[model samples]
Target: MDGNRVATLVGFAATLVVLAGLVWVVGIDDTLAALTTADPVALAAVAGIALCWLVSWGLALWTVLRALGSPVSPHIAILVFVAAVFSNNVTPFGQAGGEPLSALLISTAADTEYETGLAAIASVDTVHFLPSVGYAIVGFTFVAAGAVQLTRNLAFAAAAVAVLALGIPVAAVLGWQHRYRIEAAVIRGFTPVVTTVARVVPRWSPPSAASIEARIERFFAAIDRIATDRRTVIQTFGLSAFGWACLAASLWTSLYAVGAPVPAEVVLLVVPVGSIASVVPLPGGSGAIETVLVTLLVSTAPVSAPVATSAVLIHRVGSYLLPTLVGGGVATALGVDHAASPET
Candidate 1:
């Protein structure tokens, strides 16, 4: 096997091992019992929240794509967005793989240039980051009010919030101010990866570095055109904010289903913190997020270990399993899973 294949297999194995350890730690019997004992009404409520989340994200993607002049149907929007979610969570390189795969899927579906699709995807991501400032502020206010405790997990969460609060804005400013330089750097960074993907994936033509750079320049030009419009900016960010709110609400509903209800403030504070763990390379960030959630519950909330484990697992079912299953099915239907060959 080549190095990339070996590395991919190793990463997959490591993810499985971590997940197996998580199951063991949570206790298979206890976890199963907890799941079985959840309130049917609460589960339904959580499912509703998940459904809303799906719609909100779909709308956000649709808004960006339309603004970029590559509009897709709502049905296509949901499928591509969910498939991207599954890709990001399950694949190595975290969001790196997800965004490219999402753009590829969009290009395939909409008959648009890959560059145009990537620009639209980038717009969605940019809008999404704009809301982290608000989330961090709300979380910080709760911490200051002492409604949310400064437990180790919360501390980790707070640090993550700080990073998001600072990093994203600065990056945006820099990218905006130095669009051409940044675009060049971005193309430089992505070229090797995209080149590798082109080699491995059918229907892709490997391009010279100069051609890759030209494509990236076109991507940024497309993004800049969309970003310059005030209405597009407002609508995209508005939908993105609502999408994040749904994620927090989904977490709150999951906690309620296990009868370990916390205030909405607490949910907002911890959900983002736990979610930052998803950026880690582990599949679905299973081990890190479960640890973070368990710690957050035990130290910050009134829940016992058993209840915390159950609530987190329930949340994972809605947030991770349901979307992944649906997205995987969509990927199969779209022929995304079969797009690549073993040999470049």
Candidate 2:
């Protein structure tokens, strides 16, 4: 294997070791005891919730592929997506590793270029991020309104701010597409910075003002095309919302399975916070996600320590394990040489 691949594997192994240590330190036996005591009906409910999440994610991927003007079969797309999930989960870089695997798999399966596959991936990610921001906005508003006591915990408030901060670029891109004049003003405001960066790069060639304007116009036009198509827009946003909701529900169901009666919204908030923490690029978010999730669950919900650990473990099994295994199997069966063909 190449150096990077070796490094990735090493990092992934290290992450697994850390997770093993965490489970041991936290008393895995106690966590298992909580799981053993969980109601059978609640366990079934958690399984159903996890199934819903997988279906929603598959649907979201299907919509994005369709939007890209590719007619790839949804079954194949979903299989590839699942495989990508596996790659991402076991790899060290979270979605970064997974996205490339996704792009490569889709490219190979559909006989497309890397760029085209990447474009499709990017489009889907845009759809996903928009709705996530919408949810975070709503969640933040609730917290701000004192409908939720999030502000009482500085860590939760900071997490909320971090999510909002991440959303700013996404909102800006959407705004630039929707409002041309405003976008132009913002771009103009950044011209000096852009120019300076261009100068610092030896091979950089700055675009002329007209060229820049043309590029911006094209970007806005593409966004308008996607945004104005009511069917496409609705399907994209609807699938994203459904996926995230199901993911949240899956966590809630896990807690229920552990006999913890936490509210669904609390689970929803915790899910996003954990996700945000996991963005730190560690394999499966390793220490970061577990720490944030345990902290949040302990502080925000009415649960014993064993229940909290079991709930997170169960949720991870559904969210990470099942999808990754499916994806990895699919990827193993597919030939890498198939990637060179153009998408039909």
Candidate 3:
């Protein structure tokens, strides 16, 4: 098997271990009982909304690509986006584990520069933070205006999200300002490893440091082009915000299905905060994101542990499992195995 398949297997194994531990902690009998009571209508709505979330993000990707002057058809954009999701779900470290394949797929689908494709996807992900924090702020306002009482734990989660929202933009700015230093560091760190691998493998040759630097420059240039397009930025942000709403709605519906409905405000606050946990070195943030979601639900609303656990499991059926299955099929159809580097 190739390295990507091996990493995917390892990630799946880790997720299974986490699932077993989670079931033990939450009590299998109670959770199973809760799951059995789920409302079919509400669960159906959750699935629909989850697909809508995928579509919204796909259009956002199209917008970013157009802004970069490397446009693909809407259908192609959605296909690439879903395939990218498959890569991410099966690998570790969220996008870091999946971007190379995503980039390659985008490049082939759009017939654009590989760096341009990477820039478009990266920009979409970066802009997603703005809307997430925007929704969180809206939820925070409801709490601040005495509309909803929040527990200390939920309040702290919102605060941490606030910090992250601020940190992302600041880090982006600093990274841009020191782009050359960053470029030098990456090349310095990567070149020797590439060289050693090429020497031992004998099948592939390593790229020179100069070529690596050139690719980095092209990547930055693509980012610059996308960043400068104000109209495209607004459109991408709007789509991202809508996507966030769909995701929030899916979670809320999942809870409703399990007879533990929370306020929409609570879902908005928790979904984005839970997403932040997804950056952990776990495939699709599998167990970690679910844990955060359940914890936040229990803390912020009138949700029992078993109900919350069931709700989250229902949510993942739509968000994680469904996407992985569909996206994996898309990836196979599009030959994404040939797209992502073997290092994945």
Which candidate number maximizes TM-score?
3
lDDT for 240 (candidate 2):
78
Q: List the residue pairs that clash in candidate 2.
A: 82-327, 83-327, 86-324, 108-339, 111-341
Model 3: per-residue Cα lDDT over 1-344, one tens digit each: 69867877888888888877877798889999999999989989999999999999999999998877788889889888988888778778777777877887778777778888888778888898898898887775664454355567766786767776787779889999999999999999999999999989978989999999999999999888878889989999999999999999999899999888887788878888888777877897888888888887777777888889999999989988988899889878767545563643
With candidate 2 superimposed using the best TM-score fit, by how many Å does residue 175's alpha carbon deviate from the native? 12
Error of 3 at 80 (Å): 1.0
Q: Indicate the residue-level lDDT of 22 in model 2.
A: 65
Q: How well does candidate 2 match the true structure, expressed as C-alpha RMSD? A: 6.4
Q: What do the candidate models score in CA lDDT, each in turn?
A: 0.75, 0.69, 0.84
Model 2 scores a C-alpha lDDT of 0.69
Q: lDDT of candidate 1 vs native?
A: 0.75
* Residue 198 C-alpha lDDT in model 3: 93
Ranking by TM-score: 3, 1, 2
Model 3 poorest ten-residue lDDT run: 335-344
Please provide, for model 2 over 38-118, each residue's C-alpha lDDT reduced to its tens digit, 9 standing for 90 to 100. 777876776677777767766776766676566578777777667667766766657765677777776676665555565
